[model samples]
Every structure is written in structure tokens, then in C-alpha cells.
Target chain A: MEIPNVADKWTSGVNEVTIGATKDKGGSRQKTITVGGSKCIPFMDFEGNPGHKPVIAMDVYDIPPDDWTETLTRPFADVINDPAQWAKKCVEQYGADLICLKLDGIHPDKGNKSAEDAVKTVKSILAAVGVPLIIWGCEHDEKDNEVMPKVSQAARGENCLLGIVSQDNYKTLTATCLADGHSIITMAPVDINIGKQINILVSEMDFPLNRIVMFQSTGALGYGLEYSYSIQERERLAALTGDKMMSMPVICDVGHEAWRSKEAKSNDNDVPQWGPREERGPMWETITATSLLQSGVDIIRMNHPRSVAAVKKCIDRLY
Target chain B: MISIGERINGMFKDVREAIKNKDPKAVQELAIKQTEAGASFLDVNVGTATADPAGAMKWLIEVIQDTVKTPIAIDSQKFDIIKAGLSVIKNEVLINSSKGDPEELDKYMPLAKEYNASLICLTMDKCGIPQDVERRMEIAMKIVEKAVEHEYELSKVYIDPVLFPINVDQKQPALMFDIFNQIKMISDPPPHRNVGLSNFSQGTKEKRLLARIFLTMGISYGLDAAVMDVLDKDLMDAAITAEIIMNQHVYSDSYLTACRK
Candidate 1:
């Protein structure tokens, strides 16, 4: 008996977005990373061009994290106080493809850190790490508007990925990213329509569509992960079917969402049946990242070194 | 939706004057305007405006191509004029029609394949446009079968279930909608469904409203392409909004502008 061919052919592929710039391109990074140009869904490579491999971006914070569980903090405890060193450790030790610097301390309720503080932190990270950077905002719309613009200027020609601009408050960051020659991350609340809408809003500001990435808010394993998985799957399908509005590469916050789940964060004493906290947490993060990978996520924002290693191994084996 | 702008046809007064005077400005302006208004293809017809229609078609295509890069759909009942227009096209081409009759399909199918053009197969024959749904379906099925036998890419073949003026026959529009639904089931990944949109509103007082409403309804029943006035903003908006509602297009606040881009 002969095997039948059932491969599906698609008309369009997800847009290829390259983050970071090298000296020739007017940025100081050692290398640039490109993602999201798959003509087929996640791993059915026989169907069409598989494009580029998905990469991992480990998270670092400007200030020491106040609420991260011990399982999440143990690996990075040595350099947590210094943003630049933390970023260098993430890239050099754990083999992160990029560094995503979270400006958490700049939020008024967090520590009310100044724009100057944020800019200095951005500059230090750029100097310490040769890898590309993803500069995330503090999520407070008003404060992000004030601090991110200065931070964008601080890393002006580096071609970093600056983001988390939502539909309601994208203009400030969008203009800054455009002027600074950086790509942007448009966000929505896991609704595919709003996800597409935010991209349109950013695009209307005259920002180039190829320089944009999408973040549909993620849900961890055993939480609303199924919803995130399905939404990401739907987005990949939409991209394959030629919806230009939704065709940007997808980035999921796997570590943050996964660690927030009780299965990862709760004390082992509190839930003795759920196994040890150290192993449980990284497994949770790895499972979340790997599950979302099957739905065609292009960049994963992860936290734990063990989980990053596990997921990276899975990616290498699959490819 | 694949909007084939119906403005460049010589039946329109401005286009007729442009063709008569041999002035490229008016025709070129329409081409630019229609292309900017989100027309996927601009339909060109030298309708009764010139004794030398083949000559006029070649001229119109040259003039239009000078201004914009939108695909051209050579629209004429006479094969000679369509062939003439096809000869001058430098970009993508869509053959505006071939009758559902086997002989006509036999002629147009090879030409379409040779030019790598998308051919619109009208659900009509020598007996004229069918008034009943069953007759229209039979013709549509025949067109689909002929396309398959020709080994044409199904996606490139557009099946136009002919539409008549609502005033001439109110019952026909409803029947056409039924044909639109059944047309999808003709084959796997069925031929692109299309219609000559303005035909439904011809000779009616409420032309614009009827065209918009019928287009919105037809879209709900799976009409993917139309030869209509792209200049009519309301009609285009209605069509685009229907596409969004049907999840064919991803919606945003500025979707109307985005669709044009």
C-alpha cells in the first residue's frame, strides 16, 4: 500500500520580522534575530517553507523582583540587583537568544523610579549584553508614556523590540519606537479581534507593519492555557490564510503566566500532593512554553533557566 | 472581496467621451481613482462607444496601465475585443467572461491557461440568462466541470451566477442567492463566486440602496468577487463590513481605510 499525501498549501505566510541591528545596519548588537516567516502551521514542514526557528528571550528586571517565588529567583539571585549583570547572565549562562528587560520598578505603585533611572538601566543592559534586547514597559499607561520614550532614546539606534502598547495607549510608544528605529509589540486581552485591531491602530500611525510583533495575553498550563493555545492557533491560521492585519509574529509571556499558577508558585508544604516546588515550577513553565510553541509562537518570553533549557531542547529536537 | 471596478467601461459617459476623443487623461484618472478606492481589478469595456472596439480596448488598457498597476479584466461579449485588450495587458489579467456553453468554455479556457489569466465563467448560454435556480446551478456545475477538465486552478476560475435587474424579476435575485450557496458544493475548494453587482440595480429608482443591500446579502451567501462601482463608498463599505462580520476580514476601527491600503 502507498501512503497518501495530505499536505495543505497556503497562499500567504506570516511576516518575517527581524529584531536588533548590527553595526552595518546602524545598531551596536553582535547579531540580529529574525522570526515568523512560516508558510505552514507549526511543524508540518512538508507542507511549505518552515521559515525561521523560534527563539527564547529570557526576562530580566530593572529592580530586584519583590514577588517572584524562590523557585523562580534562585538561579538569578547573584545578579538580581544589577539589571545589566542580570541581562548578561541570562544571555551568557542560560543561552538566551535575547534579553527582555522589564521596567517594573518605574511603576508609581512599585517604586516610582524616574525616567532617568529607566534610561540608565537601558543603556547599561545594551552595554553588557551582545544579544538583542526586548524593552518591556511597566504596564502603567501614564508612566510608560513618560519613561519609555526616554528609554527608547537611550537605546536609539540599537533596534531593540520595545513594547506592550495596548489599543488604548499605543501612540506614545509607537512614535518613540518609530523615531528610535525599533520594532514594537502590540497587545490585546487574548481576543483575536482586539489583537488584530491593535496592529491596525499601530499601523495607522505610519509605523511599518513588518516592524511589529503581536502579544495576545497568555494563560499558563492548567489555567486558561487552552484559551491562549486556541487563540494563537487561530492567529496562525489567519496569517496563513492571508489576513494582513493579523500576520505579525506572535510572542507569548510563558514564564510570567506559568509561574503565577499555584502549581508553580505555591509552597510544596501547602500542596504536598503536587510534588516539589523547584521541579514543579520549571516543568509548568516548560510545558506552557512548549504547548504554545505547537500553535506557532515566534518568540517566547521565559523566566526560569531550567525551563528555558528544557524548551530549547524540545525546539532543537523538533526542528 | 475581489472588487472589479466597473467604471472604465465605455458605456459610462466619461469613458465614452475619453474613448471618442482619444484623450488618455479622463480614462487614466478613472483608473487611478478606482485603484485607490480598493479595486482588485479594473474591468475595461468599449461598450458601443467606438466602431473599432478592439482598437479602443487596446488604447484603454494602455492608458489605464500608464497610471496604475491594478489588474485589468477585459470585459466584452465579443471575443476579438477581449483578445485585443488581453494582448496589451502588462500586468495581471482577468477575462471578464465566457458563456457557460461548452463551445465558449472550450475557446476561453485554453486562452485563460495560456495567458495565466483568471476567467469569469458566466452562468448563461445561447438561450440567455437562466431565470430559475435549477437552470443556473446546472450551468454553474457545467462550468465547474469544464474548468476541472481543462485542469485549471479552481481558485483562478470565477463562476458568475448572472444577476438581472430587480424590477425585471424580483424572484430572480432570491434564486441567484440560492445558486450562490449551492455553487460552493460543486467541488472541493469550489470556483471563486462572482456577480455583476450593478445588474441587480439597473433601471431602479433606489439603485444605490438596492445594490448595497443585495451585495451585503450576496456576501453572506458566499459571493467573493463582484464587478461593481468601486467609487460608491457606501456600497464598498457595506461589502467590507459584511466581510468582517463573516470573519473573512479582521476588523479594526480604521478597517475601511486599511481595506483600501
Candidate 2:
């Protein structure tokens, strides 16, 4: 496992820096976040206790879901109809470590929401959720940059991770995080090479490696999930073996992957032989999240209260 | 080509204990180990040890020089100890460092110049470590600036761009890489560029692997020298790769030679 060493190599990311400072260390929060600061790859407990286990963040969108699966929708009931209540329930009831508010409703064309509307939604979510937040942009690359800065700004001092800075609009999104002094999630589209490339590119911008969490772009079970898993495993192996640029802790956006799968969506009428759809749907997302946790993802972006609980159980067991 | 085995400093408890015991046997064993591990030079530092730092340096230098023919870096912050160390060692000497304290460098650089010994210069000065590339470069130039300013041979001065790990923030690693790269561009006939390997691996879970990997990556940009653990196989392998990449060893054969020898 020893790669031939190069004589003239360089190292980075020394003296682990804590991201979220608490009241004691000079911040508004109750506890500060500690990430990066690793001498080795993820979870080499033999190297030393990894310091902290990966954290879980539940997804509570700025707007409710229209096409989310039946099982996930059932729990929310009328709450799904209200974005603020949905977020509140996620924190108070679900015990989410952090709330990831997706401004999915602000897609400009898809949801047809205004840029101003998106920022207001962000501010409202921040006001509603007690825990630290993760602000997400809709898949629309251009509109995300247009809206992310507004959302990132509205949630300033909260030390949220902006999801995410992509290849196209990275300049703008990264600059916003840089200027605002917040963390960021740099994602690749189910490709290890792309993930490594973005990690290097973002680092070149001087955005702070400790703040940038590499996103391997998740996929649900039975839906090309193995591809994401392999990518994550490969990336982790490279990092542990000593690719400094790719060594940052990985974050998996499991909600997007888990929710969009056919296993989570199809009802019994569509597939009667598959058994009760209720447990099957949540189980599908849960299995996906659990699998990602084992694959060395230091944090997971997940949705569905039941799925979150199941994934947490798996994380506890794995860690 | 001078690989200064960077062990034998007081930071490690065992080495410190060995010093306290005045255990020349322990010192001799470590010397042979580093020499066999391909360290061309042995860096002996009595880091933070106030108790007879000079005496310990003399003891270590004599034992190491006696056990192996490799040169030594008489490394210490205190001047008397360094000179005390230099008086005993017979091989070519590299002044472990002379920067930060202008008074120290003013005294040490000329001694190094007069003795035909090499000097390691810290990029830092009295103002402290600069955060930006331009500032570190300015400091690096200042270190070299002093060498030429003090009439020391440019080649006699080695530049150590003090490297810090991106432990707290994942983003700082590349910033560090950028700083090292900027240091490389500061001059054509560059002062030898070396880094303290352990500084980057500090507080990391995979110290050995990361240390070697970081060194391997540094080769792409041109790190000419390093103060590193000569014992780690992974580190030795990394140095071999870097030697190949930087053409210190041509056609990849030199890797086998550097490592095997």
C-alpha cells in the first residue's frame, strides 16, 4: 500500500482549525465545530481517535415537496404544506443535528420564485430553525449563484455550509462564502476525478481547506448506488494513503439521492408483489444513508425523519 | 543530496531520556539507524532542553560522528550550544537555522561563512509568520537578503519556508502549497529550499503517511531539502520519488540507489 514516495513533496492543513466557535471561544453558539485537522485519512482510529464522528443533517426545504414519496410525505401531513412549520418540526421533533434548508422552491423557472423571494425564504428558515443550517441551491447552476449569495448573506454569522459551489458558478459562490466567512460544500457529479478536481480548484482559490467539505454526490440503493460508493471509497483510500488535496472529510448529500430513487417512490398498486410500501420506502433511503456512512463520509445530508433515525442507528454501530 | 536525519531532538520523550542518561549507546544506535536509512546528514537538536543543551549537543555530535561518517546539523536556538556542538563534530556542518533573531543570524551567518558551513534560514523574522504568499516571499527574500547583505555566499544559505498543516481548516493546505511555490519563484539560483516535515504532520492521525505524501507532492514544485525522519520507509520512498521527479536521480534508477543504499 506504500506508493513510491516523491523526494520533493509538500504537505498542508496542519493544526486543525475549529469552524463553529462557541460562546467560550467567542461566538454566539453553544458549541463550536471542529473539522479538518487530520494527520491521516478518515477514521484511522489507530492513528488516534478521529476526534469526532461524522454528523447528520436533516433536510428541511425552504418550500414543501410536491413530488416527494408518499411515506415521507405522510409524516409531515399538513406541516408539509408550510415551509416554516416543516423546518420547526424537523428541529423540535426529529432531533436533527443540523437543518439543511433547500430553497428548491426558488428555481427561478421551475418554481418560478424571485431572487428576492428566495432570500426571504432563507431568512425565515434561519429565524425558524434553532440549530446551525446548511443552505442549498436548486440544481439550476446559474440561478443558484444568483440566489445563493442572497441566502448565504441572510444566514451570515450562522456559519452555514453553502451547497454548493459547482464547476460553473464556483467563482461567484466561492467568493460569497469567502467574503462572508462561511464553510462550503464542493460537489462532483458522481465522479471521483471530478470531486478531486473541484477540491483542488476550490483550494487554489484560497477558500480554506478546513472549511471545504468534499461532496462525492450521493445515489440511492439500486439506482447506480455502487458508482457513488466506489467513488467515495476510492477517494477515501487516496486521501488516507496521502493525497493531501483530496484528504478533507467527505460529505454525502443522501437526501437528494435517497428520495429520487424508484425504491422510495413507487406505490403498491405500481408493484403489488413488493409488499407494504410504507416501510419499504423509508428503508430504501435508510439503507442508502447507512451504506454511505460506512464508506467514510464524515457528514450526511439526509431527509425523512424515519430515514434519519435509521441512518443514525447505522452510524452509531459503524463508528 | 544531504538528507539530514531529523530525529534525535528533545521533542520525542525517548530521545530526551536518552540525553538525560547521557546514553551515548542510544545516540550511537540512532546514528547508525539514520545512516543505514539513507540520511546523508544527521540533524541533532536539543529542542527546549535547558539542562546542558550544549553538553548534550556535544555528546550527540561526538557519538553520531564517531558511529557514522554522515555530516550533522548542529541544531539549536541557543548560540553557545550550537558552537559547542560545532566544536566536536568532524564532518561538514549545516547550521540548523539562523533567522528570526537578527542578533543570532548576525553572529551565526558569518561563522557559517567563515567555516565553509551551510546555513538554514527561517522565512520568518521578528514580525512573525506572514499569512500571505507575498509576505512569506518578502520574508524569504529578506532571509536571502541578509545572506547577501551580510556578505555570505548565496549558496551557503538555505531557505526553510516554515510549513504549517491545514488541520483546522481544510483550505489552508493549498495556500501553503502556493506559498512554497512562490518561494521557489523568488530566485533562479535559489537558496536551497527545505521544510520541517513534522510541522505538516503535527496533530494528524496519519503522521508518517501524510509526511511522506506531502513530501512527494512537494517534489512537483521543487523542494530541494528537508529536515525529516530518515527512519520511516514511507518517507524514504517519498524522497526517492521526489529525487526522480526533480532529476536528482535520473531515469528512476536513482530511487533504487538512494533508497537501497
Candidate 3:
């Protein structure tokens, strides 16, 4: 008897979410990028096409970050203090698909920048780069509620992705994204039910679901990565099985979580067995990203140009 | 699981009375309840309720469409009644169903293709219901071949192994499951597999218990859809739990609510 094909029976697929709107599509960006739409598991091309290639969005901070490792800061030394130039260098020099502009300066204890400062950063980034932008908020809920509306207005009609709406504080950012005609990210703290609930809440505000991407808050390699990995896998499987709320493409914040681990930053002098400081940090980021990719992650937010290259190479071969 | 709600059939007393009196309220209520209960599709059958099956089916379709936008599975053994329901359905439709008999398929295949309706093909033919796994697979293969010959997308065909009453034939459920596993391997993106789930417990004392247990087992064995009573809360919970265990759903504290949403 001839061996029969064992094809996966997927009735639905990851929802394809397009970030940025080009000239004909009601935005000023030079290009737009779409991710998700995989009918099978990630990189399971033999079963079905993953549809869109996984993309890397280089992270850019709104203010100069003092806590970054020297290895991470070396590549952007000239543009570290300037958000626009920082975004430009990421796209033009490093071939980043999208620029993820984090509004960390708006935090109360950080730079304490006003909503005006946030808008200025958005305008400068729009001027510096023509590629799409993922305008993320600082984790401070009250600060995000106060400043994200202005940021959304300044980037109005640019079709930028403005986000990091948690289950408790999704209203302001979600409403602003809807009014400004931009996409937003819905987040959950590694809980699948809450992730789905947030999606329902956002969609109930009349925000188009196809424009929303999910962020099931990331965890570094030793810092609960298994929980994040399994949740991402379950989310993808739910999407493939026709669960509309869990069907949106997923984005994981790898840069912040990976670097936050002591294993990544500690050198032989700080913690004897971890290895060389320079390679340790980026290696942690790369390893963390590669693990999530297998779980069907659609967008990865990353730091360290070297780590980005490593993950991109893996994406190229797998896709 | 794609649940085709089985409450609107004329076999139910309320549905029979509704059809007899031409009272749309009873039919409309079932349509709304089933849709709210998370039924993927509503099955409408005029089962011995009226002498004019075609007319009753058209009226039933109109009432359900007016109440809810849920897609329909037009259940009838008669081609004319199926045609009547198809003509009036405003949303998605599923023709329930065609047999392996070439003549029956010849009459229904074109309607399915023209209406872009999904079809439920039974693993039975002019020779009647197959008693063994091999015979069920043989009939299923023929139905699939004919679907291909008619240029229908295999994705639109739902193959039913025609489950037998477990009370009468205790071995039938296992045989049907074995057939289900192999049938899914017959082609790339094989035809969707479904069953009349309640048939397993027909004429049994503990009907609900048998159905609930067997339905979960069938799902684990690769059944993708079913004609079922969606309002049975315990049965639905069992199905949801089975889906979670199968890794079909993301494990969440409130997965029961998540599945409905």
C-alpha cells in the first residue's frame, strides 16, 4: 500500500494584521507590512504556507536609556539621545522591517516628559523613517492613559501601531487608536483567557479586530519563558481552530524581558560562570526569540543588531 | 467543533406544533436559543410535521432567517424540500445530505455547487448502510471520488460514517472511529468528518451519558463536526474539556467562556 499524506486539518488561520497604511490606503507611510495568516503551524511549509514572513521590529526609546548594556548601546552611540535619528539608523543601517518606538520617557519617574514631548517624538520619527512604526507606551497605566491619546493624534492617518493596552486599562488607547485610524496592541500577562477577554473588550469598542495584534507579555529564558512559549503555542492553535478572539497575530517583547535577566548582563566578574558579558546579552535575546518563533510568533520586538540578524536568518530559512 | 444544532427538527414536539399551526414564534425561539448557545449552524428539518414538506421547509427557513443570521443545515431526504429550503436561505447553507448512490449525488451535486453550499455525504449507497469499517471506507471513497468528478472542493464535503445505535450494536462506535481516522487520511485536506451524535444513544436508558462519553471519544479520534443538541450544558462542557486536552484550545481559566466568544 502507498503511504498516505497526513495533512493537518485547520479550519481557520491566524488573522492577517497589516500595520501602517500607504498613500492609497489612507496613510503617509511609504510602505505597509502584514503578518499572520498562517494556515498551519509556524514554518510548517510542508503542511501549508505560513503566509507572511515573521518580521523584526528594532526597538527605539523616546529618551536616552541609562540602564542599557554598553554592547547594546555601541551600535547606536551617535543616535542614542535622539529618537528620530535612532529610528532612522535602525531602518536605513540595520534593515529593520518596522521601528518600535517605545514611549519610556513619559513614565512619571523616568524623563517625566509631557504629552507634547511624546507628540514631538512621534512627528520626528514620522519625518525620519518611511517604514511602518509600532508606537508602544510605557508600562505605567495612568501615564499611558494621559499621553497616548496625544501620541495617537500626532500620528493620525499615518496608520501607525499604537499600543500595549492591558486588560485593566485598554479603553483610552483602544479608543484613541480607533478614532485616529491606527492599529493597537492588546496584552495579557501570560494568561490566555485574559488575552482573549482583552480582545473582546477592544473589539466591543468598535475597533476593527483585523487591525489588532496580541502581545501575550514576554518572559526571558530563565524567567518563566516556558509559560510564554506554551501560551503562544496555544494561541496559535486556537487561531488555527477558528477561535476568532485568539486569532490575531501575536507580538512578543523580547528586548526588554531578555535584557532584564541577570544571566544576560552578568559577566565573569559579576557572576563567574555566565560567560563573557558582551556576547551573553545578545545571546540571551537570540535564544529567547528563536524559542518563541517555533510557537508561531508573528512579530518580535528586539534590541542588539547582532541578535536581530541571528533571528532574521532563522526566519529566512524556516519561511 | 462545528456544532449543527439539532433542536429545530420536527421530531421535537414544540417544532411539530409550530409547523402544524404555522406559528413562527416556536421556530424563531429555537433559532435564537441555539445561536446564543454557540451552535455553529442550525439544522432545520420538517420531519413528518406537514404533508407538504417543501412548503413547511420554506416557511421554517424564513422564520429562522428573520430571527438570526446563523447559517443553516437544510435536513431532508427529499430533494424538493431541500431545494425549497435552499431557495429561501439568506446566509450560508449546508445540504444535509447526499448518499453514495450515483443518481442521488447527480441530482444534488449541481445544486450544492450552484448554491456554494456545504454537503454532508453519508457512507452508504444503493446497497444501504455499511456494517463494517471496510465497507464504510469504500462508500466514503466513492462519495469523495464523485465529489471530485463534479468539481466540488473537497473542503466543502462533510463525510458521515452513519453512526449506529450503540444500544443495539456495542462494537459500532469503535468501528466508526477507526473508519474516521483512516478517512481523514484519504486526501490532502480531507473532507470534514461529522456524525449524528445522538444516534449512538437511541433507544438507550442513559442516553445523555452514552452520548456525552462517546462524543468526546469521537472528537479525540478526529471528528471535526457534529449534528448535536448544543443546549446540553454538560455535554458541551465535556466537548470543551476534550478540546482543551486535545490542544485545540489555549488553556485559560475561563476557556468555557472564551470558546463561546
Candidate 4:
């Protein structure tokens, strides 16, 4: 007898979420990116429709990072201080599908920039890039609540994806995003229940579930990567089995987590066995990203053009 | 969770009046409301009040299909009434249902396969409703075996262990649950299971509450679908919570809203 086909009997699928609004849809983005809606595990072509191919968003910060390693900083060295020009380079030169603007300047311990400054950064990036934008807040709850509302309004009609709303502090951002017509991300600390709870809380505030993405905290390779990998896989399985609360597209912070590792950031002089420091950092990011992609991540926020290029090429081949 | 919304039946006062007056508006509104409330399928029944049951069934199917694309469950005991509704439906449908008796299966099984529709087979036969768990399992296995012998996809056959009113026999609910667990293992890839959920609350003082509580318990034991009131907020909330607690769904603070979405 011929081998019987073995595939999952998926009852439901991930929610399809569109990030930017085009002019016809009452936003200024030249193109909108859609993700999720997969009825099978990522890139299992023979099983079912893979729905949308995964995309990458290159990260640009409102204030230049003073501590970035030489390998990570070299590609955007010229535009480091300007958020708008930095965003332009990510889209034009690096071929980013989307630009993720991080409001690091608004962090109290960092520059303590005002909401107005955050809004200014948003408008400048919007002017510079035509692709969809994901506007991320600095990871402090009180500060994010203080500044995200203004940033949400600044990008209101443009339909940016704004967030980092945690379990403790989703109210202000959730309400503002609903009113401003942008999607938001719900964050959890690698705990699946907490991840689901955050989604439920935001949904209770009446933000449509399809307009939300999920962010389970990332743990880099050699830095509890297995924890991140398992949680993402669990979330995807839950989605395929018809759990709407866990069905939103997932976004991972590859640059933020992978670079934090000593293995990825240390100098060759300090750890020569790991090879050249230049190739080591991007390789760490590339490896971490490729692992998550198999576990069903919809979008990855990456740094280092070299790692971004390699990951993008991998995505093209798989999809 | 394949929720079959049960409000469009002509037994309801509003639906009876709508059928008598030949008004499609009331029936159409129920179809849209139930779809919004997360009904995977809407049960359309021309109740006992209709003088021309087949005509009413056809009209109900047309009105519902015109308003929404959600699938319909042609819910009538009479094969002719089911045929009337099936002739006009443009989308996938569920023939709800057949008994385990050979004659009944012989008639409806082929029609179900011919229309490429799914079916709900009751765990009862020409001998009548099975009182014990053993008889219920026997009838359920008979339905599955017949479906398989006919080359029908077992997945398309839904086995209902046949819920009974708590007021009639308080012991029946426990027996029903035991039969449900047994019925699931009747075949290799067992047929999906559901209940006419409202049957458990018949003649009860707090009818909705009784039905809601029983359905939640049944879900914990692996019930896959139900024909129930989707519009009852409390009942729907209980269903969502039960699925979450069972880990069939991930827990969310606003799980109630998420399930509807």
C-alpha cells in the first residue's frame, strides 16, 4: 500500500494581522505587511497552507546606543544619531520589510526624553520610511504608559504597530491604540499562562484580537534559548488547535536578546576560540533567529545588516 | 468547539410567530446574532408549530444563507424536512441526525455522503433510547462501524450519546458522561461527540443554569461540540472557562471576548 499522508488535522489557524494602513485604507504607508494565518507549522509546505511568509523588521533607536559593539555599529555608523536617516538606511540599503523604531530615549535611566520628543521621532521615521512601522516603547512600565499615548497619536492615521504592553500596564496603551487605529503587542515573561493572560486582558479592554501580536520575552542561544523555543512552539500548537488568545503572530527581539550574551558580544582577544568577533556576533544572531523561525515566529526584530541579510536569505529559501 | 446555535428553532415563541407570519426578518436576525456570538453552525428547525414544516425549513435555510455564510445544521427528525433545507443550502451542512437503526442509517448516510455533508448519529436505535451505558456504547459502535463499512469518513460522523433531562432521571447525566468516554474509543479515529445540550435542563426551574453547568462538566470529559444557546452570555462564559481550565484553550483574562472574536 502507498504510504498514507501524515499531517495535523488543524481545526483553526493563526489570526491574520495587517500592520500598516495604505492611503486607500486611510493611512500613508506605501505598503502594508500582513503576517500569521498559517494553518500548519511554519514552512511545512506539504502539510497545509503556510499562509503568510515571515518578515524581518530592522531596529532603529530614537537615541544612538553608546554601548553597541564595533561589529554591530559599523553598518549604520553614519546615521547613528538620526532616527529618521537610520530608518531610511534600514529600508533602502538593508532591504528591510518593516522598520521597528525603539523609543529608547524615553527611558528614565537613559535620556529621559519627553513624550513630545518620542512623537517627533515617530513622525521623522514615518516621513523617512514607506514600509509598515512597529513603534516599540522602552521597557519600563511607568515610562511606557507616560509616553506611548502621545507616540500612538503621532502615528494615528498611519496605522503603525505600537506596544510592549505588559500584564501590569496595558490599560493606557491598549485604549490609546484602539482609538488611534494601530495594532499593539502583548508581552509576557516566557511564561505561557502569563502570555495568555496579557492577551486576555488587552482583549477585555475591547481591542480586537486580530489587531494584536504577542511578545514572549526572548532568551538568546546559550542564554536559556530552549525556554524561549519551547514556549513559542507551545503557543503555535495552541493556535493550530484553535486557541484564539494565543493565535496572534509572534514577534521576537533577536538583536536585543542575542547581543546581550557574552558569547555573541565578547572580543576575539577575550575569547579567541569563538573565532573573529565580527563574524561571531552576527552568527549568534543568525543562529538564534533561524531556531525561532522553525518554532513559528512571524516577525523578528534584528540588528546587524550581515545577520539580517543571512536570515532574510534563509527565509526566502524556506518560503 | 463546534457550537451549533439552537435559537432559530420554531419552538421558540418568536420563531413560531415568524414562521406563521411567513416573515424572514426574525429568523434572519437570529442567524446573524448567533453567528456573531461564535456559533460554528446554526441549527435551523421548523418546529411542531409549523403546518407546512418542509416549506418552513426551505424558507429558513434561504433566509439564513442570504444573511450569513456560517454553515447550517438542518435539524429535523423527518428526512423530507431535512431534504427541503438541503436542496437550497449553498454551503456545507450538517444533517442532524440519524439513529443507529439500519434503515435509518441506510437512508441518511447516503444522502449525507451525496451532499458531501457531515452527520450527527444518536446513540439510540429502533429499539428506543438506551438506558444503560453498555447499550449506549453498543449503539455508538454500531453507528461508527456502519459509517466505516460504507466508506464514509469517520471524522464526519458525530456521535451524540443522547442527553436526558435531570428531572426525569438524575442518574442519567452520569451514565451519559460514562457513555461519552466509551463512545470516543469505539473506532480507531473515533467519531466527534456533542449533545443536544438543552435536553439536560428540560422541565428544570433554573433551566439555563442547569444546562450550562452540565455542558461544562461534559466538556471536561472531552465533548467536542454542542447544539445549545449561543446567545446566553453566562452559558457561553462557562463553556469558554471550562475549555481554558481543561487546557484546550490557553487562559486569557478576557477569554470570554477572545472566544467570541
Poorest lDDT segment (10 consecutive residues) of candidate 3 chain A: A265-274
- Model 4: docking quality category: medium
Q: lDDT by residue for model 3 over A1-319, one digit each (tens)?
A: 9987777867789988899888888778999999988999887777776779989999999998888877788999999999999999999988899999999999999988999999999899989999999999898999999999999999889888888998899999988899999998999998888898888888878888899999989998999989999999988888887888889999999988998888887656877677787888899999999999999899999998989989999989877
Show model 4 residue runs off by greater than 4 Å.
A21-30, A204-206, B5-40, B60-71, B90-92, B149-151, B166-172, B187-189, B201-213, B229-234
- What is residue B21's positional error in candidate 3, in angstroms? 9.7
Compose the digit string of candidate 3's lDDT tens values, residues B28-142.
9999999999898999999985898999999999999999999999999988899989999888899999887878888888899999999998988878998899989988888
Candidate topping DockQ: 1
Q: Which candidate ranks first by lDDT, i.e. highest?
A: 1
Cα RMSD for predicted model 4: 3.2
Q: What's the true lDDT of residue A110 in model 1?
A: 93
Question: Least lDDT summed over 10 consecutive residues: which range in candidate 3 chain B?
Answer: B249-258
Q: Evaluate model 1: give its lDDT.
A: 0.92
Candidate 1 CAPRI classification by DockQ: medium
DockQ of 3: 0.34
Which of 1 and 3 is the better model by DockQ? 1
Standalone chain B TM-score for every prediction: 0.97, 0.90, 0.97, 0.96
* Prediction 4 TM-score vs. true: 0.88
- RMSD to truth, every model: 1.6, 18.7, 5.1, 3.2
- lDDT of candidate 4 over A1-319, digit per residue (tens): 9997776677778899999999999889999999998989888867678889889999999999877888898999999999999999999999999999998889999999999999998998888889999999998889999999998888888778888898888999999999999999999988888898898888888899999999998888998878989999999999888787889999999988898899888988999898997989999999999999999999999998999999999999998
Regions of candidate 1 where Cα sits further than 4 Å from its true position: A1-6
